[model samples]
Target chain A: MPEAVRSALAIAGKDLRLEFRTRTGLLSAFVFAVLTLLVFNFSRDQSLISTTDLAPSALWITVAFGAVVAMNRAFIIEKEQGAIDALLLAPVPRGAIYWGKFLANLAFVGLVEALTLPLFVLFFNVPLGPALPGVVLTLVLATIGFVAVGTILSAMVVRTRFAELMLPVLILPFMVPPLIGAVQVTARLLGGRPLTEVLGWLRLLGTYDVVFVTLCTLAFSAVVDE
Target chain B: MPPEAPLLEARGITRAFGAQRALRGVDLRLGPGEAVAVAGPNGAGKTTLLRILAGLMRPTTGEVRLADGRTPRDPAARRRVGLLSHQSFLYDDLTARENLHFTGRLYGLGDLAARASRALEEAGLAARADDPVRQLSRGMLQRVAIARALLHEPDILLLDEPFTGLDVPSAARLRGFLAAQRAAGRGLVIVTHHLAEAWGFATHVGVLARGQWAQLGPRPASLEEFLAGYQELVDA
Candidate 1:
């Protein structure tokens, strides 16, 4: 319903505003992602690292690492300020909160991936063309999947004794499937493989996004209810 | 519905953490506009009981029912109940008004802006509606939590340590708020160690030791006798 959407957007908007006003997390994610990409590019020769070779792997890897960094800070301030309880008590569907967080994190991660993509292209001379849309779509799916797992895990670990150390330890293994699918599809496309040849990976990625998102929605109440 | 049906009925509620028992076969009730104060030392399962009623935690052995015959058989039914805890469950990132609107929406209230505005006004936070909750003092934050509970006009309001961190003024205002809510035909339950504060507003009082209810009913006319009874329960 519109009411739920409004509430979800309100929670999401508040989060986005907080993140924007204090760009510390997003900036760190961007810088770390760019640094990783740079390191990857320089490690190989220009001929070996071209769009045909490194474009797919580099883009998805940068995205994966950037999202992981950003996810750690997702609930950092909320837990510190004791604001999460208020959000949990609101009447909005628990699922909408999931959407709000997923979308907000999506926007931030996507921005980093967007910014990092061009740099990757420029550095590796990967021809972006029509393939760009497919890549962005893949990025969105992967980001949603990653942020879904991240938001729930972040909420759980944020208040624990050692949050920063514990979150990645719990979340990394679960994130592997999405990251692999993202990198594989990107690589196959950059290698000039036909969409049909790589469509199965995209299907797997899409399925992961849908299934995990639904699971997160159903299970998020347990996370905040604690 | 039986005229004698307790306004709120808790039956066979049991919760445990590891090998320790927080609550075991606890049963209690509150009539309309009545108050129940739960007194117990730490680790007595007082909080665990409140959380279970608020749907934050599930009972290991029992169920909560509306004495008015409106049982909380499902999620929708449970949403109508209110709970205020020591945690001051306010999102510090949101303004008082924003927080109200958000909670109101969760309760499926339309015209959230108007309800939020009215609740803020009622709580005397209307003037500071736009200020983030973190900027407010502990007293003001408590007021915001109270406003959120009353925003939906729930039939049952649960207060757990409502005055623990409050200043004198905030505590007085909250007592007034609870009395007014009782006047509104809502059942009020206060869980606390401050028997004096509980006596000030609650028409009914209960002593909970370990996991059992030792004494629960109308406040004895003689304050001295009730205090003696309370002390006896604590010591025994």
Candidate 2:
């Protein structure tokens, strides 16, 4: 691997270890995801909206909010002891630091999705037998798009007084594109629609991922620079 | 780069925050085997200057450069500078050894395990290497931060109040360590409030007041002379 990638991976690994050791951030996100799912399960009028109809929206909504919770911790850890300055002083490209945080957030959000999926199925009674692959693909692509945008926004608000509140406010707008894409693709997939029909949404999600990832990676240096 | 070139140089460096200026037209040159101790009152911009020198912050109007004419913005050039700020720059959950290992990885240094081990031993934290940083005392945390700063072996070191939390023994050890660094031809710019800390090691001593150097020159011949000079500048 190239040195930058190696450094990025090292950072990601370190972040993962810290998360696993403390478990506070991840646990809170997981609990939030579960609570969101429970609220959706209990409040919906089952006669009007079948489990199939509610599954996609419920899952995507949980993910969108859960992601905000997870990404909020991304830069908060660095801010704790002012570790971000040390990271900034290192002889590595700024893009590497951006990618490191991006990848780490990707894993964090991905794990939340993974843990939430089974509960989502149990609560909604949604059969994901044939559409599991499509659902997984939608999850990955949409996650990349939102996490790409979220990583940079997290860094931007980390220095602010109201970072915790500011993150969801700034991030929810950007999360719209991918959340809509994921819900559309997932709803169609679960409704037994053909794969051919969901291709447009997938393409939109792919484009969003590529465009935002590149733009955010480029903007990160300026965001973190003093 | 010529052998005689200053290891670290800054010219006309100024930084401002909105309506307030923190530093203005400050300049410094640090040559190999030389140490400069910068003393100043509160709000003198000593920390700001150190941050700019460490490349953690860019000056609003001036520039800092390395021996080869490369600015701190260059990744390669940044590798030659080490910084120890007031913040420990350590994760509370990680152990001391892990912190060193992580820093080594950031610098792309090889033999991380050995290097971290040696650094822990040198800081007298080998027994506590595996303990989480949150469990260490303030003095121990400072020691770990110092070790982390020096682990990569940079050519120039910019330390901001490095002795803040150190005990008497640790402070003496740090002074000895810095003297050894000077003996090894490394350049140092140490920022401190106490003049005694810089007494024997600093080849030059300067005072910063209101964001500019009030007085900057060679070390006075005696402690009394240096104290008198420092008092004169602060009083002015």
Candidate 3:
């Protein structure tokens, strides 16, 4: 019931309500992700490339791009309505605003990923039965990394002329580290490699998440203050 | 004991964007029950000054402080200031009532429903409270924007060209509402180009030219006198 938490939740609730009313970001991202899975499924010859080998890269790529699409609106909506100024004028700490947007983006990307995971299975014939838990963990960590960077970068680019073009360009470079880490762990999990063997990748993802989330949170006030 | 300090004070505020200076050593002080009108030509930094005063932007030099000595950048101080800029700042997808409720919650106000309903009624948007902001006309949007700004009942209100898009009736209503706020002893700073309108309400008038205050003093006895004085200052 702390004020910060309450404020953050209020922000998240407002964003979620807006998204529910329009479903613009979620629907577009979901469709884009599904199409990505289908293209990957159809382009590859089943005999040459195994589903397990392709699934990790394809899934991670799809999620990353889909996440970018979702994050495109994270700050754009605020900027379009000039609501960012309203938000900045509030008494809440700037970090809470960043976290609120981060959480909302996380949920959005998670939803897209959840809906796409089933289609990924249907198209790739990759059994997620035993590896589900590990895959989920990797997805969560990787998403944290994606959204932390995306949330901050989205705010940075929202004011620019080429906001849509700028978001992916600015965010993709930072996303490389986390995406690589996620794909490797996902490949390992799908291949039945021991958890100990993929520990290093998980650690990398965790470090990326923790470092970027902290750095972005700290940097948000400066970015929006301008 | 010393008399209470002004509700808001800005000392030596200067702002520059790259090679261009927008504000130059501006000092302003507003006390309770005083409404100051700032009039300036285009590119005179009136909006910039208001933004700095609202804590939405940092000054290149000097600082803004509340009566309690908290800097404008302080969250606590921000809670005491309300700003209505040229931008409505309400979500196009959200209803008028929702916008008020959302802003009220951001300020951590209790009894949100009652407060939002009251603001809706005050702004005369009660019937259309559930309609999205994008569906409203410019005048209605301005009214809702006013409601949103006043939802928290801040001690100081900073308005930038609030009458820009309002219809005649809406403008008159806003003028009346702002007068009521002034009567209630809230400090106000309004930036506008409408000399006569500002002269009608402002207890003090300031003329900003080329990022500097060319004239700052009491309101002239008549609109004609104020216009003549303003023309003399600008022409000089």
Candidate 4:
């Protein structure tokens, strides 16, 4: 493996180990996701809005907010005891550090989504017979866009006075494009529309992922150092 | 590289935070095997200077360069420097051994397990290696942080208040370890308020007052002599 990749993997491993050991961020995020799903399941009357219509919005909403909760802890770990400085001072590339954090956030958000999907299905009675793969692809593609943006934004806001409040404020606006794309694709997939019908949204999500990931990686050093 | 080129150099480094200037036109040069100790009152920019040299923060003005002509901002050049600040820079949930192993991997060191074990043994924390850092005492955490900084054995080491949390025995061990590092041709820059601690190993001494050097030069002949000079400079 390339040295940079190796360093990034090491960082991701460290983060995962810390997450499992403390179970602080992941647990909170999971609980929040479950609660959001429950609220959506109960707040609406099935007689007015059908489960099929609400499922897409509910799932994406739960995932987006839950993701913010999870990504909030990404830089907080480094800020604790100022470990970020040591990570910055290492021989690894600055992009590697960003990539490491991004990878870890991706995993955390992905895991939360995985846990929520089953509960979402159970609570809302959404059908998943043939649309499972499409839904998964939509989740992955949309996640890459927001998580990429969130990783860097987390680093930027970590030093701010009200980081927890600051993160969602800054990240929510950026989440719009990808979230809309995700919701549209998910709604189509759940409505039994063929995958070909959602290709435009998928392409938009793919393009967003590429652009934001590259921009975030390139801008990470400036965000952390300055 | 030139035979006598300094391991690190800073020219007129001035760092300002908005309207408040923390450092003013500071100059420093550290050659191989040499140790420079910087002493200053609180808020005198001692840590700021160290951070700038470590490439953790960029100076508002001026430049810092490694012997190889690249700035410390260069990743390859950064590998040649290690910094131990007041914070342990360790994850509290990770064991001492795991922390060392993680650092070793970041530095791309070969034989990570062996290096981590050796570092744990050196810190005298081999017995407590498996315990999470949150379970360790302040002094033990400091020792682990010190071990992490020295794990890769960088050419230049930067320490800020290294002796703050150390016990007497650990302090003495650190002094001995620093002397051995000097003997091995590694350069070091230490920031401390304690005159004796700086006097113990610094071949050169600098007194900083209000972001500028009040006095900076070779070590005085004796601790008493350096103390007199230091007091006079701060008094002025």
What digit string (tens of lDDT, one per residue) describes model 1 on residues A1-226?
5866876777677677767867877999999998998888788777644557666777777877788788887777667644565455455567777778777777788888888888888877877776777777788778888888988888888879888888878888988999889888788767666678878888898899889888988998778764
Q: Kindly list the per-residue Cα lDDT of model 2 for residues B20-70, writing each as its tens digit.
A: 999989999999999999998999999999999988898999899999999
What DockQ, between 0 and 1, does each candidate earn? 0.48, 0.91, 0.90, 0.91
Model 3 lDDT vs. the true structure? 0.90
| Model 4 regions more than 4 Å off | B1-3
Q: List, residue by residue over B47-117, the lDDT tens digit for candidate 3.
A: 99999999999999999999899987898888999999999999999999988888988899999999999
RMSD per candidate (Å) reads 3.0, 1.3, 1.4, 1.4
lDDT of 1 by residue, B136-162 (tens): 987788888878877888878888888
Question: Which stretches of model 1 miss by more than 4 angstroms?
Answer: A2-10, A42-52, A73-93, A155-159, A218-226, B1-4, B67-73
Model 4 / residue B199 / CA error / Å: 1.7
In model 3, the runs with Cα more than 4 Å from the true position are B1-4
Q: On residues A65-143, what C-alpha lDDT tens digit does candidate 3 reach at each position?
A: 9999999999988987689999999999999999899999988999999998998888888878888889999999999
How is the predicted docking of candidate 4 categorized under the CAPRI scheme? high
User: In model 3, how large is the Cα lDDT of residue A14?
Assistant: 91
